[model samples]
Target chain A: MFNTRSMSKLLVVASKDQLDGIVRELYRHHVFHIEDFVETEEEGYEGVKIGMPLPQASAVSTELLRIRAIVSAFGVARSDVVPERKESVSALSARIDAELPQIEAEVSDLVDRRNHLESAIRECETKIAELEPFVPVQVDLSLLRGYEQFSVLAGHIPAKVELPVPAEMYFSGDVSGNLLIAIVPNERLNEAEQFLFEAGFQSMPVPGEEGLAKDRIAWYTQEISRLRAEMEEVDEQVNARKEKHQTFLVACDELLTAEAERAEAPLRFATTDTTFVAEGWVPSENVEALTAALRSVTNGTAYIAEQDFDPVNDNVPIEFDNPDFSKPTEMLMDVYSRPQYTELDPTLLIAIVFPIFFGFILGDVGYGLVLLAMSLGLRRIITGGAGEKLLKVLRNASVSSIIFGVLYSEFLGFALPWEPIGINRHLNIGAEAHGHGPDIVLMLVVSAWAGILHITLGRLIHMRNARRMYKPGKHRNKVVFGQAGWILVMWGILFALWSMFELPLMPSFTGLSPIVAGMNIVTLLGAVMLIVGIVAIGQENSLELLELPTVMSHTLSYARLAAVGISSVAIAMVVNYIAIGMMIEPAMQDLSLMGVIFIIAGIIVFLLGHTLNTALGLLGGGLHSIRLHYVEFFTKFYLGRGKKYDPFGMIRKFTED
Target chain B: MAVETMSVEVAEASARGLVAIGAGLAVGMAGLATAIAQYGIGTAAVGATAENKDIFGLVLVLTVIPETIVIFGLVVALLLLF
Candidate 1:
């Protein structure tokens, strides 16, 4: 498909009493993209104001919030469980009113108990760890604290220190550091503190409890185990509740969400005292069905009519009309932006061209096979999301890579059994290997030719889009002519080069007799076209003439296809040379224990090197290929910042109407 | 006479070595230029991506737009070597 789906503007008018029926019908049809009404001092809007939400909106929102809380408290994620069956809205509403509060109470009670138990366990654990250093000192905790006449210093010190004043001291340490406890008379506390400070002492808090350190630790550990067991019991009770009510809670959530949306739909409509008006865009083909649905619901009282809209003036929402196979490439289009409603959609073209560029850049059988397997494997693991779509794109690119690999006659940088059916990428300049080494010049030229054709196609698309988008006028003609000029200049350059040089895979016109001075027919034609094209471009915008060099540079840019591929091939070859020629071969001849170890090490090197190369190949190939499209190709035509189509409806998963 | 011929051979070998060095510099300097350009673009792209992740594809394309310079260098290097 070349364009987005055609949209028709719909205006619906009904009495306020019929608003509910109209809204329900429209939502069910799921074809209308609502355009909200904002009050302004515009003609025909004098009596109308923004509509208010239905009376049930607040109640529906409250219920939805409660359901979400239950879902989160149970850690029930949408992806965590599959929807078993759809529940009717009536059944879900009944369950919500009857059972939600009781379940809420039970869950909150269990969650609060679990939280209290967890904090208590943390407190006990902290106490045990704090008292752990004191265990080796063989002191009672009561002796360290609650002394009326004696002051104590207990903590770690850099080294053992003798108390300056008379005191009882206990010290234990290893080469790293020491823990010390000093008990002195209150009068001599200053002296003990000064000495400890000089010894780099870091103080520890003394526990207020009364018991030996080891005994306290033992008691705390026993308490912790008991609390942990209780915690487990609480968790099991919660799990049982989750198992029983997860499906219901999920269904209620779905039902309430849809209800909330419906209840709030009035806020987007324009309302007067007695009537309401709704305006939205619907696909042109669905207008009849929508009108029928609305009329049936309103008992022929509601007025539904299609309004005339100009695509140039109206901000119509764009929904891509690409075929199913090209739908995934819409993700690529989204990365830029959606195409404007009247503009051409390039999804199909990208689907066909993007992978070809990727394949050309990463043409190697081994890497292609590995990437294909990885994408397929990852697809099975992650399904039904953007990640799966990306994997699908990668799978297509990998298939292309394999096809190119066959043409290039390469398998992980090694020569295949047959000679290259396409351009050879390997370079063996002087050696008579593989008939002839890679034609580097030919590869670059081919890449450039690919760029020329791709850009030319882009310019052609731009010209067509311009003709369709603009009315017949001088301005429209200028835009179209500018695009045509760009195409002509590119081809003219190609023709001039062909005439001047004996390029590979190009028609040689240099052998033709010169018509005047030294210029042949091809060169003369190329010159005339270049002058005319430049003039045409200048007429459109003289400033654009400064960008003439870009045509040449962009053509050269596609040479990255060959250049990056060659680099990858070179890395693979070096990897193989080191792993096999330098290490494995020598080890094979030696045939000893060290030789076996070397062989194993070589294999590791081989695998690691290839793995790293494969990852690089994917990154480089995909980025460079897409870059050619985004920067060089798309810059010629694409202007995408269109509004996305978001019809007001729900695609129910866990519940049904 | 023997010494003269040996000196000429030495000159040819040095010339070949010099050409190799030239090719290496062409690619290496262009790569450095690309890196310098990417340093700023890449950091800004990362900051933008942190704010909103949907623009990652666009920023990725922007970040690599400068890499064409290195590819140009590679083309030059290939011409020199082969």
Candidate 2:
């Protein structure tokens, strides 16, 4: 159950005529992950050309593209309603070909009218801008062009600039003076140009349009309004057409896409003139359902057989099988990477260990209750995908935190009425300055023990893999010895550390007398094992001796588990202290109205403060707990190098058959 | 104020000052170390997340691992005051 299901290759052969129906049935069932069939030329096997898409594949694909374009042009959003009617390929293809032209023509007529109106509006607007310069001057367009001796030096200037020019050189433009039509004598044009440049001007050509300024402006306004109203009418016509065919277009696109996929699927198989053979992998348990489905689909004309399982082929895809409660833990595996076909499926292990670490770090009944309410109570809002996955993992963490919280007798960092089952934190830190609920020796002992146990599990898995893989022309013996040696050395150091620390959880060795001048039997025995294991590993690489000290540091890294949790509890305590200092602690001392107000305000602070701390605790606790498993535990044995099984099938998110 | 009383107040003030300074060094130095470690990992984590949003959860877990060092230092500093 902890291992990947051993896979068997399957060979499916069917008549060329029944191939399409067979493949469609297989897809709708979604059991098989198809593998491209490879041909060999040794002995009975002679490789031949692989199959190609059928003659109808191109037609279906083109139809699909047309339907997609029609839907997009019709403003049919994916979430809009789609008809459930399924159509035969020939009928859909024929209908799409016949109706596409009429639909295209109908839509284009409205589009052409709207596009024409838009262009007319743009031209009118440009003319209006050109006539703007003459608006302030109150000049007739016909009069400005007839200037003889005084040539109008018309040009653009920076819109915001205001420069005083000679009275004769009248500047005529709106406040946005970008269109300037200044009239100056022909001889003075040179001096005027220099003056204009210094005043931030860029020369522009004058328009030959003839009419009074007011009339031209009025004509442009009226023309633009008329064009816009016509455009609205055109838009209404297009929208009505879209409303009529939106559902049909969406449904047709889905149908054609599915048909195209079915038509092209045969390209992955090998085929003779009359027969086709497909190769793929199916879970052994699903073989019966698959075989029955194929037989039913083809009227028992198709044949399916289980091929030999190739033990040496490392290409087998991994599929996790875990109990329902542990299923969410698969998200952890997916986010990191998949385990190899030969590697242990660590989903169940993660399910068991991940929450325990999370709870240990964020051990508080108050926070646990809040987290539980948010996770379970807010489930309806969380709905799906990443949010739901987070809630599921948080559910387990909350439950464990409640359990650990009970042991610690902490309710939001305040002591509950009940006695503590494990650590009475008030007495641990409140009475003694240096003492703490988590910084004590007991927590350290537990962390070290957890680290040692975790590493041992990894090394054992490594040893089992090495032993199973024993083969000729391989240095498999060293692999086994190397793991065993490390295991011994790690255990020895763990026992030695335990003897040196006087922690509450340490197993008492007082029953036995010390051996070899003050050393206990356990520590001495551990030292001897450490020497032997070091020597065994040293046989492989002398430099590995240098890494032995690193193992001790690795063991000490587990102290983070204690460190993180202790800090979290400390934060909770301070929040409670401040809240009480402001509210409840003084409520009993005074029965005044001000005290009542203060108490209410303090309650608000308490809620807000604990909420912030609890959120941080969740982030810190969740992160560090998983970090221990990913960095400290998995690196010991699991080397995840596997390919994901991505079979050919449309997710059909936007449209469905 | 008498000379003896003044000296006693100054001595107590100096003692508190030393405690505050000690606490600051403990937290400040640990925070700096954590920042250095996180900057390297955080850059890679953001780049990886941009390429594939699916790894966001994993990267988040890895990114906060260095924070424990600062939190541990906070605990030590708090204990030192006591």
Candidate 3:
């Protein structure tokens, strides 16, 4: 659990006669992370080219494609609905090849019929819409057309439109104020159409078939309903078939994918006419197990060897090993980079500190309880959906917040009437009470102390790492002295500042004078440490002296923990004061119509205000707490570029392994 | 002449006013500086993290590192105001 799993390189050589058995055995073990073979001119490593998959690979691939098309058509991909039974791959493929074509034909037949019905319905609707506008006019539709000398412009015009028509043109209007027809000499057709177009008129499309508008409307309605009824029956059939085959199809997909992956594995192997070489990494502990499995499966035809280790740059894949409780913090490594196999894994440290910072910022019992409930309620969905890593982190953070919240006696910033078990930050209640500002300063001091411990621990770890990385015989001291000096300076200045500010809490210097004049004696100690630190580091580069101010500011930065908490609580208090104190209390004291409105408004304010604070608390608290670790703590020691381990076998989502 | 006519209580109140202004300036300017720094860092951090998500944790830390300036300002403001 202290570091990444130990890894070693394994070389597997197999004769052509036993290659399949060895490959299958490796798949079962799922240990090897295969490296792609690059053809080299070195002795015994040269090859014609990478070997191709067995002759059966092409046939399996084609069958797999057809199954995919059917599966895509059905579109059922839920991982939860796994098959209750397991069947052999050959049997599954045969069944798929035999049954799928008939099913595909059936489904396509229904689809084609549905498409035809839909188009017919659309055509009928278009016909009905065109003829409806002409229904208000009583004249027979054929009489409106087929004129040689006369032109008929029949359309809908505005209800009260005045068109400038010459004496030669004739206009007809219907009582429904929709149908309009203008008749004029063929020579005047352009003039009349232009006039009608200007007067907001739209021409209706004339239908070719001879039929009454009423009859056509009735016919179209009947046609549409008939198509819809047929469509419903087709949908039912398709759904029934889908429900019956979904599980089987998912199993087929998994089998096909597994087979395809295995068949393609030969692409990474360097092969000659009769033998193959497989080079990959497996954990040192699993090397014996892999060797035994491969030998047994291939009847001693497959041989194995261990390559010599390279300490400086072996490029082994990393796999972290942590206790169950700290596993969620492994997710943080993904957000950051995984530690190199040679270096330490900091998941345990992150698991401990991240939640402490979270709870400190969001300390309120009521909010914590709500968050706890939300995270717990979503446990199942989170485990199945995005992941349980986030849920676990949140669970720890919420638990911490609850502990801190009860200590602070805050239930959404209302300041509970009872005394706190420890200390309540918002304790000002009477005329002689200390105000909010001083209380905030006290919180800042607490944050600063936490920062001091966090930074000191970081420096200790950094110094240790640097020492470990130093060459064995080299006397070069690049780390320990510098970190020690900085730690001394930080602690020293903290005491000095506390004394200068006249704060009640100040760390005492062991067996030394507390203060001389206004300057604390610790300040004198701090100056000495700073100068000595610079001298030790000056040999490498004196420019680091400038970083003293930056480092001091970094320590001050931890006060944000207190600053964030104060703002969060301040908002909650404002909400409670305005919503309850100003509105609800007044409404309760005297009942009236306006009072009832005030009570309603007060309740809304209370709910919305508290909910908003809860959201802000989760977002700010979670991210900032993470930031403290990443920026303030992790920067001290960790450097990451470790490759992750990828096993050979796929997790079977559809069938039993 | 205005200072000579001022009462002791009035003079003390004015001194409190000036201190409050100084505290406000300390925090305000500091906050502005933090915001400016974060604007550039936040954008670059986001862009770099998008290319490789593994840098997300480190990018987040760098993005918020400048926030310390505001806290320092707040400390100064509190000291002055109190």
TM-score of each: 0.93, 0.77, 0.82
Clashing pairs in 2: none
Candidate 3 residue spans exceeding 4 A from truth: A39-45, A80-94, A106-238, A384-386, A421-423, A427-438, A467-470, A473-476, A479-504, A509-524, A536-547, B1-55, B73-82
In angstroms, the error of model 3 at A7 is 2.0
| A1-657 per-residue lDDT for model 2 (tens digits) | 677666667788988888878878877766677887676666655545478787799988887876777776677875555445555557755767788788877867776777788899999999888776666656667766677777776666765344354425455445465566667777777777887799888775566677777788898899899889888888888888988877657656766777788788888898877888998887777788888888898989888898876543547766777788888887777777777777677888989998988887787898899899889987887666657877898999899999888888788887778867765444333322333434345666677788788778888887776665456434777877888899989877766756665446766554556787888887787798889899878876788788786576566667677767777777777767667854767884987888888788788888888888888889888877887787777777776655566555654543433
User: The CA-based lDDT of model 3 is what?
Assistant: 0.76
**Candidate 1 lDDT tens digits, A1-657:** 988999999999999999888888888888899999989999978989999888899998988888898898888776656788888878887888899999999989998999999999999999998878777766667778778999888899987778879999888884236788888999988878988888899888887778788899999999999999999999999899998898888788878887889889999999999999999999999999999989989999998889999996688999989888788888888887788888889989989998999998899988999999999999767887668878888988999999999999888877789888868887552223345567788889889879988999999999988988899999999999998888888888777878889988778898988898798999988888888889888889999999999998899999999898888888887788778877899899989999999999999999999999999999989888888988998889988778889998877788877
- Candidate 1 residue A325 Cα shift, in angstroms, is 2.0
Give lDDT tens digits, candidate 3, residues A81-128.
646777766777677778878877876786687688888888988888
Best by DockQ: 1
In what order do the candidates fall by TM-score, top score first?
1, 3, 2
DockQ of predictions, in order shown: 0.72, 0.31, 0.52
Worst 10 residues of 3 chain A by lDDT: A429-438
- Candidate 2 CAPRI assessment class: acceptable
Q: Which residue pairs of candidate 3 clash?
A: none
